[model samples]
Target: MGTSWSARIVDAPPDSAMAIEAVLNRVIAQMSNWEADSAISRFNAAPVGKWMALPADMMTVLRAGLYMARLSGGAFDPAVGRLVARWGFGPDGLTGLSAAPNHPAPWTAIEVEGDRARRTADVTLDFSGIAKGFAVDAVAMALHDLGATHFLVEIGGELRGQGVKPDLQPWWVDVEAPPGLFLPTLRIALCGLSVATSGDYRNFREVDGTRLSHSIDPKTGAPIANDVASVTVLHESAMLADAWATAIMILGQDRGMALATRQGIAACLMQRTASGGQEYMTPALAAMLE
Candidate 1:
């Protein structure tokens, strides 16, 4: 929610921009940790073991986050908000701390029932990894409801496309690569699909000359220290794509690719190697290329 969003629509209603902004605002109200009154912030401040009623939109994203956490075996955790804050990525800024108490599968402590969710432990919810993607899908749906069909919606870098451009050409986007990396540009059409990528280059902090990525490993309660430069995933749902990208990035190159292949996820991963940047595409992505 800290970044900007844009939409390229064919025959979009003049008022469509306002509608899109309204949808994004709702997501920010419910999910942005930067806002002190956001649903996520309230839930984080809620008394431990007390069930807190949350808006449907927050519930939706929470469910998706928990699902990804389970599917990735804790590689993608929504309960790492405190960890994020400790690293200066959140509202509290950096505390100059190198690490925190590691919790084993902290996401498991959260329980959801109906429109209510509660945490058994002192866990904080952070949707930084997935909320933007959900906002993209939300805006896209809002556009569709406004009778706009041909459009491409993007929040930050995650994107979703539907129908086609006025020229009847598919919405094609070049996959992002880290700067200074020499790799053949790869492009994909996001017709009725969404793509999200998690990379070490997005956000970080330099500690004693070491660049620490914003992506914290739930398993370690610290920033991810891996060779993985980035991992991109494509899904029909932007929310899922966003979560999967984070999950795969946390899993690193080998295990991430293996799990992605096993789950039949279209993913392309790049890692910084001793020689240089190396790219790997899963079978699902290879099939897409073919």
Candidate 2:
């Protein structure tokens, strides 16, 4: 949670800003890996095999994380926190060394029973991929409860829009692209929709001259190595969009586009090439464009 958030709403109540802030704070307290006392940190610190009771919000995020892990066949694992830390992407900071996971696909070992959850292995839970998107959806719901029908919510780069603007226009936003890429700009009307993008250009580290992306491949127990520059996903639920974007990015263009087509996911994948960059749009996204 090292970024900013904003909300653009029509007829916002005086107290709506405070309510939005409260919702964002609540999500941070539950999932921020930077916070030592966050619920996710507590779960990561908890002894393996011990069931820990979690707050409803934390439980919800964890459930969704595990679901995406399974659905993506470990490509979008929430239990890759140890790998994230070793790669200098987490609170552990950068150390010039690498390590492997004790278990392959550690997410499969996570078990959630009602409001309680536990891990069978020494896996660290990180919600970095999906938490921000969920926060956007949460803020949107808060706005609705505040009697605002038309609003747009954004956290970091993920965004969601509901209803329309004062001018009766849908909230239109241009999806992000990697710099220096001469790709066609893609825009979408975020009416009851959410969009999330994962890219190697954003958060990265240089190790002895080689740039390493923040995206850790759960299968490899290391940073992903591919030409995939970024992947964008559009969904009704920002949480799903965020997770899917990360998953598809890890899968690369060929496999990722195939997966997107099979699952009927609206996705756009961009890859770095010798000249510049290449783009691929899945049938789901192409249908939307048409």
Candidate 3:
């Protein structure tokens, strides 16, 4: 919610323009807290004894989240919601400058039944990582359905683009470094693709000169501390890019790079050095950039 978003549509039909706006409104209805009766809230409110029927959109994200959990070895888990809340990232809220509260295992201990899901362990579901990207994709699809062939849809720093801009150039994106700095940009001819980034510098709290990031490792129920300053991912779906970026950040440099390579995900990692400089992309990611 602390991020900014913008969209530009070129050579779009009038109907398509209206449809794009409608789709964004729907996303707000489903995602904004003011619209508390949305599907996500229902799933969160469902009692332990009963399973909730999730909307198709929610289910889509849940399935992808589970896959990402497996792929990242639980480094990225949406079920870390309870832990997030304990640290003030959740609705109940934070402990200020103090350290985040220790949380129990995530909803990974939960059993999912079709549209219904349950946690064997006590945990809350947090879709913060994937939701924005999912929304971006959804918005892009809405535009596409309306016969808009060229556009970039972005929501809270997550984005998906299709076709060529009016200038006939590929959609170019820049991955920002820590403290909100951007270096060499990555350009992509967004025929139909999405990109997302998650970094510690985005939304965080400072405690005694130490900045505590919102991204938590479900494995340790703690914030990850590594040399990596940021991670950006590119994929067919913004949701995948979003979740994978978080996973790679938690996984850190070597292991994260290996997983990205094995999974065939194009990624870039920026690491901070002791000399106050930054290290650029990993070999695999560099190749993708090329």
**Across residues 1-290, which tens digit of lDDT does each residue of candidate 2 receive?**
89999989898877998999999899989998899998888988899999999989888888999988888889999988888888888886887566577777989889999899998988889899999989998998888888999899999999999999999989999976699788988999999999999998889988778879999988888888988888999999999999999999987888878988999999999888999989999999999989
Total backbone collisions for each predicted model = 0, 0, 2
RMSD to truth, every model: 1.1, 1.1, 2.7
Residue lDDT tens for model 1, 108-152? 889999999999998799999999999999999999999998999
Model 1 TM-score relative to the real fold: 0.98
How does model 2 score by TM-score?
A: 0.97
Considering TM-score, which of the candidate structures 2 and 3 is the better prediction for this target? Answer: 2
The regions of model 3 sitting more than 4 angstroms off are 1-4, 15-18, 28-35, 95-105, 180-189, 280-284
Model 3, residue pairs in steric clash: 88-93, 88-94
lDDT winner between candidates 1 and 3: 1
Off by over 4 Å in 1: none
- Per-residue lDDT for 1-290 in model 3, tens only? 33556778897667765675676666655544334576666566677556766667777787888888888888888777766765667655675434433444465665788776765655666788888888888878877777788888888878888887888987777655566444455555555878888888767877778877888877666677886778888889998999999999989888998888888888888777766545545555567656
TM-score per candidate, in order?
0.98, 0.97, 0.88
